[model samples]
Target: MSSTFSLKYMSRRVSCAFNLLQVCLVVAVLALLVTASPLFAENALNGAENTAEAETEAGVAAAEVIQAPALAAIAPAPAADEPLSPRMRAALGYVAQRYRVSADALRPIFHAVQSTSQELSLDPLLIVAVIGVESRFNPFSQSVMGAQGLMQVIPRFHKDKLPANAGKAPLLDPVTNVRVGSLALEEAIRRNGGLMEGLQQFAGATRDEDQTYATKVLSEKQRLEDAANRRLGRG
Candidate 1:
């Protein structure tokens, strides 16, 4: 056989082997992706669990923050997607999980809280904590005291605070409820001369003297912050 023909055959064999190797590598990669996809999905779906360690840290951080006299010193929650900070992501993840609600559903409310907190010089987490305590984020929640919506603002008492038109319908709207509820909370804090006093008045539990309502609200806010700090690995 000619040396040329022999060399050509040898070259063809190497080329074929290389092509087969490439095909095998591609197949292996595809198999890996297929097998690992569910884990990725679960990780995405269970993002709440990813921040569990933050809960404890969040508790301590939250406690410190609530006692600080001004919630505005704490980081502000994000209202927009484009500029979401790590803390905002953690807050959303934690609250969504804590309240047993979807991130999508929680977002607009968070945005409203952000806007209202900014407007009122109040901490956004405090508003979120209020929502958690009053309604667990249920936009349609109503109380026996005639309180309605996420913030549990009784329409009759807070008519002036409700969105224009003097109706209870606006109170049921999650965004509107958060905005108005936060305003109410801000006013309560102002009238009572402090955060604790304001919270007591807001809950109409001023006579209790134990300040249970304020403590619960502050604790809830602290948990959110701890979770956020933990998620950021600050915990």
Candidate 2:
């Protein structure tokens, strides 16, 4: 073979080999990138899951804050009977009869009173008495002073006591009204340092003559207590 031909032939072979090597390198890089794609996607998914978990924890923390006060107010159960014993049933019956309300209507809302009493460390009977004096178990009752609902709580004054889910429903809603009213009474009692004083404050009675309102409430409370005792055979 001629030298020029041999040299040219060898150069062409080398060029072909270099081209093949380049193709192989490009294929290898593409394969590596494809292999890494799944890892990248997995990392993104894990990050999203972490964010969701963090949000869930934050929601739970907020719920705890809203619920802690009510939970902490619960007292130990009575040893002789459940919190709403036969005595309480009698009281409910008496109130229902005296107020001309349906016993079924009174029965359903006893849960709210019990829950409030537990949360506020107050007596359910006292709450019932207050309701009797305030609205006579009328959920739709409204006062001339803008006081509304079964407990006649002024909505604007106690808006902070409303539950988160309580939308634009009128303050006359029995459940919402009772909850806020009970909280207001709890605050009044705490502020005045005595039940009678609290009742006076709740009634907006600042003067000595204003005590009549408190006296009425106390009288109602006694009547309900008597009724409950009678039912339990303790009268």
Candidate 3:
């Protein structure tokens, strides 16, 4: 009986050792899974972020592709009856600021200048320069010698050059003045055979002291040309 009891106690001790070993193995496996959990979670988060970034980039590219043609279609076209180009407007503003002239008053006259220059086959800057020197754009200006208006055209001498439709427009009128003066200048150019000589004759500068008149007009013309060029973005 003593032998049987000792055998039983030994068997029970071996069973308890086995159960402890199994418990230790399970705890070790659980620890290993816990250690790898953060790594797996980090990898999943990184993958998700990369996918989101790619989607955002694709969305931006698609938006740009969709918007491109719409933006082009909405671009403004040049109008048929637009009175002034941006460059022309800039040129006018520059001249008006530099000369202290009323842009409102002088603006409409530029159209006339352009048309008249084309009709007369003359450089528009030359006429504008002469107007600057003659009356500083003052429509009511009159000289002691009876020269009147912006270009100071002498009414008595240039009466024949007046437009037939002028009717009773005075020499002080801007349109009639410029028309008559341009015609007179054209005739003077024809008679003298050159621009400088024609300008001198137009000024009636017989004395040597008046030699600077043509030079001043030409200088102003050069300034205006440069202003126009700058406005056109060619300077």
Best by lDDT: 1
For residues 33-129, write the lDDT of model 2, one tens digit per residue: 9999899999999999999999999999999999998887763222222345576678888887888888767765666787778889999888988
Q: On lDDT, who's better, 2 or 3? A: 2
lDDT of each: 0.84, 0.83, 0.80
Task: State candidate 2's TM-score.
Answer: 0.63
Model 2, backbone clash pairs (residues 3+ apart or across chains), number: 0
Q: Per-residue error at 145 for model 2, in Å?
A: 0.9
- Give the lDDT of residue 70 in candidate 2: 84
Q: State which candidate, 1 or 3, has the greater lDDT.
A: 1
C-alpha-based local distance difference test score of model 3: 0.80
Task: Report how far off residue 136 is in candidate 1 (Å).
Answer: 0.7
Clash count, predicted structure 3? 0
The lowest-lDDT stretch of 10 consecutive residues in candidate 2 is 75-84
